[model samples]
Target: MEHAPMSDWTTLPRAFYQRHPTVVAPELLNKLLVRDDGRAGRIVEVEAYAGSEDPAAHSYRGMTARTATMFGEAGHLYVYFSYGMHWGSNAVCGEVGQGWGVLLRALAPVHGLALIRAARPAIRRDTDLASGPGRLSQAMGITKALDGADLVRNDRGVRIACDGTAPPPEPVVGPRIGISKAVEFAWRWHVPGHAHVSGRGSRSR
Candidate 1:
């Protein structure tokens, strides 16, 4: 894993995540989530999980060891296991102990197509590489090990950096996907017509 140059790239600060989950979600668009090995994916889709108040959030029922990272400081990764098989990741938002975070729903492969393809052999087209939360996590080599990593640092195993990208078409909002709980909550946000968005929310979005 090599650290990419900071030229034209700036790690997003913690203050950027101090707002509400909904506010933080759409704002992540176009930022590059770079892995230590130089694999970078441009964020194009996301879902906000508002703490305690929103039933879909892991923090809704209160904090456990598994949900502890969601309650930790902002600007950290909150990777988790899902469906008893795959891993999914989120960028923690809101204040420390707030438990709000934005699920990294999808990405447009940017920095390492070959590496991401090796990580996900079932993928034939590049658009399918990170079209869902679990696939996004797997494609980026993110696992439970980076559950609480600081995404605001350049030296970390994974970091989210600004790339001066023009914002995608305005985000489209829809109900949260996959989970049965709070299925009606319109918290999912994604770039309209972006091929990288997950299947679960496409119809509604």
Candidate 2:
């Protein structure tokens, strides 16, 4: 599908994210994540992580310096370093202190192709530019510095915008990847048959 013009997009309101991660995850599909420099991509895959009951979540035990962003008000970015190597990005969700968020897993590049390529020089396919959480963060220049960036207020010119494309009526659902605890929660969601999806098989139930 051809990418839509940026002029047609609108930043999602804070109320859109003021819900449980499970409710916001699947609905995020097809929304555009826009950066100030003009880099943008359509969200295609995500995973919902909740507090307390969700042992895999960083805020499951309680908020620390690293997870403080995750517990902040909704409609903000929550970035974290993973495995001492790569950064992963999430959209903070639910009310303040709720400690819920949606982990962005993959995106279909929509704008700033050249920038995405430069950030992911090792990648050979366009579909691979942001096909994983680490890759997505790298492609979009997300880092711990952006952990508390506000999406609703367009802080630092980064925000999640809608481009008139509705989310999939039936998103593919499966267990989140690379997690040991709560392995059976089936919280991951993605656009079905999208080339940019990072993983396959059982994730498409």
Candidate 3:
């Protein structure tokens, strides 16, 4: 499918995210996720973790230093330090004050694979590159430095671009993995049968 020319990401308005959760999740697939390091990638998988209403959502507990980004303006980056070692990236959604985010679970490399590999040499197979949230952030050089950066424009150095290519029809949604709560929500969305989807059972989830 043809893609939109690269342009500044215009933060999606509040109403855009207020729509049904599942609808927004798969719509994000195939969008361009570009980093300042000249490395750009495509979002292949995502998980919509809703507001406090969703037990599994981080915002379920209210505001904290780590989750504050999730509550901010729409289209902002909500990055979090995890596992005492890596960072995960999410895109804040919903109304300005509602505190919702769409977790960018995995990416399909489209540009700068060499740079990604140089950063994470342990990723030998092509499928492993940017296959998980933490790994994708590290591989793409997304860190605290980029926390709260605007995804709507390049002034902040990195931004997501709409490629105009709709995600494949029939994305699969199921229980989110590696979470303690809301596991029953079945909120994760991924390409139906893509090999690069990060986790085991990705096809099922």
Candidate 4:
């Protein structure tokens, strides 16, 4: 499917994110994550994290300095450094203080292919450029500096945009990966048979 031209891309409205993560995660498939530098990617895999009720969520215990961004208004970026090694980014969702988010697990390269390749020289194949959360962040130059950045506003130089590519009609559903707790919740959604999807999991109802 052809992506809409950059001139036709529209940043997603705040209203689009003012809902629970589960409701927003699957819908985010095929949308474009854009950077002002011209890097863009088609979202293909995601995992929803519901605060409080979700034991695996970073904000389940309450707000802390590290998790403050996760509790902020919807449509903002919530980036976190993981394992003291790499960063992962999430789209914060729901109302302020609700702490819901969708982890962007993988993206299909759509723009700035040369730049993406340059950023991830260690990756031999283009499909692996942003196949995992940590790799995705590195591929897009996202880091702690971007935590809490506003994704609804282009003022941040990064935003989620729609290029008229519709999400998958039947996304593969599975449990979230790389987490020790809440292993049974089927909150992960990915485009079926997409090569860029991060990991394998049992597809559930």
How well is each residue in 87-202 modelled by candidate 1, as lDDT tens digits? 98999998888899999989988777889999999888899999998899999999999889988874357888887775555678888887778888888888877778785534
Candidate 1 achieves a global lDDT of 0.85
Per-residue alpha-carbon lDDT of candidate 2 for residues 59-177, written as tens digits (9 for 90 to 100): 99999999999999999999999999999999999999989999999999889999989999999999999999999999999988888999988898789999899999889999999
Pairs with steric clashes in candidate 2: none
Could you give the candidate ranking by TM-score, starting with the highest? 4, 2, 1, 3
**Tens-digit lDDT track of model 4 for 63-144:** 9999999999999999999999999999999999998999999998999999999999989999999999999999998999
TM-score of each: 0.92, 0.97, 0.88, 0.98
- What lDDT score is found at residue 162 in candidate 3? 65
| Native-to-model Cα distance after best TM-score fit, residue 52 in candidate 2, in Å | 0.8
lDDT of 3 at 121: 90
lDDT of model 4, residue 71: 94
lDDT of 2 at 8: 81
Candidate no. 3 TM-score: 0.88
CA deviation > 4 Å runs, candidate 4: none
- Please give the CA lDDT of all the candidate structures: 0.85, 0.93, 0.76, 0.93
| TM-score preference between candidates 1 and 2, better one | 2
